[model samples]
Target: MTLRIALRPAPLLLRFILPRPSLLLHQLPTRRAGHGPGQRVIHYMGHQAGATQPPTPHKTIHFCSQCAGPVDLKFVSSEDRWRHICSACSHVHYLNPRNVVGCIVEHEDQVLLCRRGIQPQLGKWTVPAGYMELQESTAEGAARETLEEAGAAVEIVAPYVHFDIPGIGQAYLLFRARLAPPFTFAAQAPESLETRLFPLEDIPWDELAFSAVSLALRYYVEDRRSQSWRMHHGVIRKQAGAGPNDPGSFKLTDYMGLPLGAERIQTQA
Candidate 1:
């Protein structure tokens, strides 16, 4: 594996925009044939390169962090495409879905959500979530973020939902929580446009930036009633037209000529 890079953060929105903190730690594929769990993996470069298209993300591989040894590469076709396993220690350097953590901070039947005043779905609504900081627990990150974004104190209730996907390298973890009574809020200006507590019915489904928020809400509702719930991938659910060797270069955004939220965030310079 010639490309030797350290673990990096997830995309801007996944890290900075959501309300839940989800740190997706994955084991690397192993290099040896008979191996233990958590070993790292490496996918040697094949002769045929996909130059004219988006690089096949699945074909990507990783190497040993210390020894620079060859790691294993185990790529499941459907669900597990996101992780690159190390063949040796089964060590996993999770691909970027960039650990996001947020709380479902609430009071009675109402939920808390924040409005974005910044680019990348600016003016859209979502929870008070963000990327995990070094030396903090996921729950800590979530609780701390809730206070910062909403400017309201909160207590985490229970673990609610998790959105996992390998290809796009993003995951989400949300918790049920209650805002400390006497809820007080300020714009927190740039991070959010406004923060409010709303009854479940008042949530604006149409204007959410990432699809995971709605998916988490849906799962939360069904979970409450003992209804059969499916594990939703949130933003990175499988697509039907994808080929085994398909390069994920083109999509609907290309057709509509819409600007990606990241693009807008960059232009704000």
Candidate 2:
């Protein structure tokens, strides 16, 4: 026996319904209630193509973490600067500079350098370094970054350089480190395209990645030449008429030791 199947149109209630013109007029409210004449009414149905968009929030932080409320920039008396404050909860969201920790691993008069596989300066050489994680000391972060990037286990000797980049809201703490026993390292890691040791006289100054790395290396070389090892503090400021990635774009101002090509300004004790 053959079975016959028949096709039928969908029921009227199940069909797509377009709103009546009068019903649309009542349902779609263009102007918000209680607004006086001459006030702007945001039309939700209007085409907003080619409209100017709002500026992006700094560091991509647009909402409060505690209450998930919309945040706006307001002057905080305690901070003495504009900070993001929650509209509903009145909570202040503090935006602070981030710390980057790393080590300058030294072995037999040579320093370990890694070619970055990531950006901001991809393919450029730098000492092993990355952002510091919470619950870890700066020295610990340095050793961990060194091991992860250059695959070398190192004993941090001392904090060598404290460099600040105010323009980018970052602080770099670089330490002098000695390679552990056996003095071996993997040629590359996940974050590094290549790794090599460069002697003091053979450092690729022009090919170095960040200003902080270059400045730290310069301090190390200067100290090595004088046979004196001391901690250094400095700030890297972007100079006018120079691009961010330009080698000569940044001016290094040393707060402790004398920086290259600049005389130290002495302050009265």
Candidate 3:
């Protein structure tokens, strides 16, 4: 009984003096409005990519940080600014013009097409496309638009095709895609009024949006054999009767009698 030695617990005072993990965590303060677990809560309020943030007290339009585009600031009834964002791209769009992205979708030997139910090319056949939104890769924008406009999913081929429409202040990024077999559109997607498929010969040349589309089509005909190409102003430059078919071949040629401009395409061109 005498062998027992008493050990006292650490005094409460000593425990109270020790540093706790909670205190360290408190050092990192979090903003009251976190965008999400991983996202930062940023208010578009009046800012856009390629534009400056926070209006100058009474300014209406702000610039965007990403593209320097003008962000339109609309005041509510009380003159309070309102936000309008593209649901697909999640960018704080300014009142500036929009950028369009498109895809030349393919399955088997045929092409995917859509007929316009609205004006500015209404009742015309064109590749799947629409406006590009904020915070989206060019290719992703192309694919997303293809699905929204046509209600189909596709696998994109490498190296996007780029085009700039002069005088219209429009830029285009087009992608080559392989349509997911048995493709169809999703419900409630309102960008397009109608969707259809067609053979290359059936493409509505008289109704397509721009010449670039025809250029792309001509390039694809040539691409099946080789990737080297030269396209200008929405026209396919093919040598006279260079492709599998001559009826649609180039219309011009160079000094060497080589088909020049969009007129002459090579065989398999």
Could you arrange the candidates by TM-score from highest to lowest?
2, 1, 3
Candidate 3 residue-wise lDDT, 198-229, digit = tens: 77667666566544465456555555444343
Q: What is the lDDT of every predicted structure here?
A: 0.54, 0.70, 0.50
Top-scoring candidate (TM-score): 2
How well is each residue in 1-269 modelled by candidate 2, as lDDT tens digits? 11122323322322211222111101221212113343232223543545444344454568889999998877544434567889989898787899999999999999999998888688898999999999887877888898899988887666788978887889999988888866788746559999999999999988888878887888788777876666666567766555434765776542344223221211111
- Model 2, TM vs. native: 0.70
TM-score to true structure, per model: 0.52, 0.70, 0.47
Candidate 3 ranges with C-alpha deviation above 4 Å: 1-98, 185-190, 225-269
**Error in Å for residue 211 of model 1:** 1.1
Clashes of each: 53, 0, 36
Q: Least accurate stretch of 10 residues (summed lDDT) in model 3?
A: 252-261
TM-score of 3: 0.47
lDDT of 2 at 153: 82
Q: What is the C-alpha local distance difference test score of candidate 1?
A: 0.54
